[model samples]
Target: MIEKTRGIFLHAVKYSETSLIASIYTEHYGRQSFIINGVHGKNSTVRAAVFQPLYLLDLEIYYKAGREIHRIKNARITYPYSTIPFDIRKSTQVLFLAEVLYKCLREEETNIELFDFLYHSLTLLDLTEAGISNFHIWFLFKLTRFLGFSPSREDAERCNFFDLQTARFVSHEPLHSQFTDKHLTVLFTRLFTIDSSSIENLDYTQHERRLVLEKLLEFYHIHLGNLGEFKSLEVLKEVLK
Candidate 1:
């Protein structure tokens, strides 16, 4: 049966001379893989260009439970980005975030709230001009809420240390090394209150930004053991710098 849905293009690899296997996260079905046949052909309906990282798409798909892959009957870019592909800073961040989402978002069920959050966030990324440098840091922190481990802020005002393993603030430093020191904790906790509307006002020096990102990734790694090193990390850091 053909079903209509909105999707976010995550990653893809060439499966044949003229075909590609693409992973897309959909509004109704979560993450899914689709094979686009003859996408390299001149008359292909679904152009390969639409599969770019984090591109928002409208899709008509043949979905079946227990199948490893689904067929895209039709696909179109829902919102063509005006700036991300053209700007190196924005492009790098999109690539990095796409890679992270590819690894972290594994649920095979509908999450309307999560889907809306991503769709709007990417749209914002393409539109926003200020605070571009700190976008990824803010995104990573916000993602934790959907992943079920958003850090606890009940003690944020009174605590000086943030225990990554526990996902909360500690009055004293944690015994293990998976914790942020007082100074970094202050920077890390500030992300808890920051929203997309206020992201433009977020100002972080390069050093502070890098440290906070490292801590956020570390926190993710501690919770999601399968999320190893990111290949796009160095590139994103270089681009942002």
Candidate 2:
């Protein structure tokens, strides 16, 4: 049977001389891998354009209960990007965030809310211009809420430090190295109150943003232990610099 669903392209790799393997996060089926054939053949009809990172696609696919890889019957872009592909800054951000999502989102079960959040957030990134530099930092914090390890804010008023390992605000610096100072704790509180309507207000210098990003990655490392050093991170840092 064929199923129609919405999906976001995560990554693709050359599988053979004439084919590619793609990982996509589908709204209905969760994370799935598919083989896209004839991508390298000159006369093939399947355009490679649909496989770009974070591309929104409408797909008709064949799925099975225990299969490691599936097949797609049809696919096309659902929302055309205005400038992500041509703009270096936007494209770099997309690539970095897509890599993060690829590493973190591995569920084989449906999560409509999570899917909706990602779809809207990516769309907003493509459309926003005022706070592009701070987009990824904002996205990183928002993503944690859905990942089930959002930082604790209840102690913010009384505490001046953020314990990364414990995911909560602390009155004193943690004994371990995995902690943030009071300044970052204050910024974390401000970030917690932001959403799409207010994301543009976030302003930070490159150095300050880099510090926050490093700390956020540390938080992720503590919670999601398998996330190795992200390959796109250094490139993103340099690009933003």
Clashes of 1: 0
lDDT of 1: 0.92
Candidate 2 C-alpha lDDT tens digits along 1-241: 7899999999999999988899999999899999888877897656687899999999988888689999887889999999889878889989999999999998988999999999999899889888888899999998998898998888887788999988989898889989889888777777877789887788878988898998999999889886987889888998898
Q: Provide the lowest-lDDT 10-residue window in model 1.
A: 185-194
Instruction: Report the CA-based lDDT of candidate 2 relative to the real structure.
Output: 0.89
TM-scores of the models, in the given order? 0.98, 0.96
Stretches of model 2 off by over 4 angstroms after superposition: none
Per-residue alpha-carbon lDDT of candidate 1 for residues 154-213, written as tens digits (9 for 90 to 100): 899899999999998999977899899989988987887789998976788989999999
Evaluate all candidate structures by whole-model CA lDDT and list the values in order.
0.92, 0.89
Supply candidate 1's per-residue lDDT for 115. 98
Candidate 2: worst-modelled 10 consecutive residues by lDDT: 39-48
Q: Would you list the clashing residue pairs of candidate 1?
A: none
lDDT of 2 at 91: 91
